[model samples]
Target: MERKHFLKSLLVGAMSAPALLAACGKDDETVAPSTDSTSSGSCTVAPTETEGPFPTKVPASYVRSNIVDGKTGHPMTVKITIKNANNSCAVLSGALVDIWHCDAEGNYSEYGGTGMQATNYQSVHFLRGRQITDANGLVTFTSIFPGWYSGRATHIHVHIYSASGTSLKVTQIAFPEGTGSAVAAVNGYAKGMNGYTYNASDNVFSDGVTQELATVTGSTSAGFELAITLNVAV
Candidate 1:
């Protein structure tokens, strides 16, 4: 789908332009996950992004590491570390991290048959899961490399909460430079990189992606690994 058509569909779906922009994520990029921070040990708080339009309505029901429930694409291992910005970037154990994203065809599960997404995946949950941080403040999810949509870039939505269930931060992960190639290599999906939007033009990532950028490695044949550390003010 072209960008304009997607935007028109969103408008017809009762989502305004500003709301749609606020609800999108970023494009692809590559880097190595940092140990202490997004870059160096700066401990900058990851920016708060939107969680709307298509969030997991029942995250507690899907507390598993493998979220790829029958979806096809390059295998992706998503490793996210949560850090406490108030405590010198210490690993925040026991935080709740929930993530959801579109499948290889740029369509999200639990949401379809609408103007925003014509695919009917509303009855199934494919790429959505939740996990609690371990002692190392890390949560790993086995998923597929997400495809891009017309108005937004290739990205993932993340919602973090405390062990007690208090919402901490809501954000998205951005990919690096090699994402375009990865998308093109995927088997399913007719779009490929034709209408894919880059981070520079992505409404959710145009300003900057310093904190949201993730380190992506591996090949389309072997799959990919993504690692990102999110700093939250606790």
Candidate 2:
């Protein structure tokens, strides 16, 4: 979704735009190997971006290694390795990573006063959580295929914090169009296929998404796996 939609979804009591266009998790079932890596010659830091407007400041109860929180859709396994850009992109362990995204219908949990979908969902917290990176600087989240809103492709929001709880980086991750197209064919995500914008036209990813796109694998039947190396300055 565009920045404006994010603001409207989180700021107002209701939104006039398409309900599915409104802006908006983790589990520890398994530790998937990192399918994405940075070569020795090219280990630049992931591009920093906004944290999106929908992030809640409420205390999160779902801070364990698993963050699925019972929400349902095509399963997605997200594994990200946090690295210190100042240290030649070496893995930086124990940093805190917070990730959140909309559900299959594009409505964000813990925040729904905007009348995008559920009204009583304002206090509900699903598909939003945090996890501390392991010794390998890896954190995994089990989530669902994210739904798309107007002006944006399928993506996820990430915020990395230092071990001292200081914010280090804010960025978004995108999925390849092919991945999105395939997921859209599924039951819940079909709505996202319409009016969906590609990466080149998305305001946040227009510059380029090579560094922000996750290396996604698997399928809608068995679920998908997304892995990426998030290099940040410590």
lDDT of 1 by residue, 1-234 (tens): 111122333555576433464444433222223334434645577877767668898999999999999898889999999988777778999999999998988888998796667899989999999999999999999999997777677889999999999988878898885436554456235675665677887777888998898988888778899999888877
Ten consecutive residues with minimal summed lDDT in candidate 1?
Answer: 1-10
Residue 26, model 2: lDDT of 15
What is the C-alpha lDDT profile of model 2 across 1-234, one tens digit per residue? 112334534455464545334333111111122222456345566776655556756534568555567877888889988988667666889899988888777777776665344444676777777888989999999888887666567788898889898887777888766535444445347583666777777767777776788887777888888888877767
Model 2, C-alpha of 204: deviation from truth (Å): 0.7
- Return the top candidate by TM-score: 1
Candidate 1: C-alpha lDDT: 0.78
Clash number for each model: 8, 6
lDDT of model 1 at position 52: 63
Task: State each model's CA lDDT, in order.
Answer: 0.78, 0.69
Model 1: residues >4 Å from true position, as ranges? 1-41, 178-189
Candidate 2 pairs with clashing backbones: 26-66, 26-67, 26-68, 27-66, 27-67, 27-142
TM-score: model 1 vs. ground truth: 0.83
Candidate 1 C-alpha error for residue 226, in Å: 0.2
My TM-score estimates for the predictions, one after another, are 0.83, 0.79
